[model samples]
Target: MSTNAAFRLQDAGFSRAQVEALGEFLDSQAATKTDLIEAKTELKAEIAEVKTELKAGIAAVRTELKAEIAEAKADIIKWMFGTIVAQTALIIAAVKLLH
Candidate 1:
């Protein structure tokens, strides 16, 4: 049937000042932990969003590069065909003039 000061405080016989101070301290500790958790979650979400954007950007660049390469290949084929036809005509004219 005996109790201590800590027990009396638990039973609500303590002074208002002491109880309020203890409550404020507990609340501050809980708030700090909650703030840390929220900050970590927000940072992780931001990082994931940035990674997704970067991947999309890289894919777009790759697609553009592939299109450009295909266009260059077509241009080269046209140039090669034109050069061969012109050279063949020059050779035929020179042979006729010499004969």
Candidate 2:
């Protein structure tokens, strides 16, 4: 950036301490800009890593859920067959008793 204000202050014969303070402020601003850029780059990289991990975790959970659903279906079918057999036996016993 232009140091117009600093130059004007110098031309207007400001104290040596005041001019040095302005120089220090300009140096700090430059260092701050560099630090901000580096921080932004690091944050972007970390976000990408987290996104990848989340995708992998979601895929694993989906696979586990599908397996559990299939097991539940098998259990339901087994219970249905057992129920049908029991009902048929009960009906035959009642018919024999009536006879």
Candidate 3:
């Protein structure tokens, strides 16, 4: 590929030295297989880290929701108990008045 590009550059009236220099510069700029592999490894590591953080956050939110639901259940129970007691008292009072 470099040879083809260099030949093309030479055909375009570039000097031999300029073609060689440009070829070298292009080679320097190109990413190697090793470079790509290293980048892929780093990307995988970063993705794994993000997944761990998200899992931890989800677990925390689940725990908080469970606690909130328990508190609401307790509140409902208290309200139900109070209503039952008041209803019983009124019934007793009405029965006494009738008697």
In order, candidate lDDTs are: 0.85, 0.90, 0.94
**How would you encode candidate 1's per-residue C-alpha lDDT over 25-54 as one tens digit per residue?**
766667577799999999999999999999
| 32-83 per-residue lDDT for model 3 (tens digits) | 9999999999999999999999999999999999999999999999999999
Please list the residue runs of candidate 2 whose C-alpha ends up more than 4 Å from where it truly belongs after superposition.
1-26, 29-34
Worst 10 residues of 1 by lDDT: 1-10
Model 1, residue pairs in steric clash: none
- Which candidate has the highest lDDT of all? 3
Report the candidate with higher TM-score, 1 versus 2. 2
Q: What tens-digit string does per-residue lDDT give for candidate 2 at 3-95?
A: 787788888998767888878887776857779899999999999999999999999999999999999999999999999999999999999
Which residue segments of model 1 deviate by more than 4 Å? 1-31
What is the Cα-based TM-score of model 1? 0.63
Of 2 and 3, the candidate ahead on TM-score is 3
lDDT of 3: 0.94
Give the Cα-based TM-score of candidate 2 against the true structure: 0.67
Which of the numbered candidates is closest to the native, going by highest TM-score?
A: 3
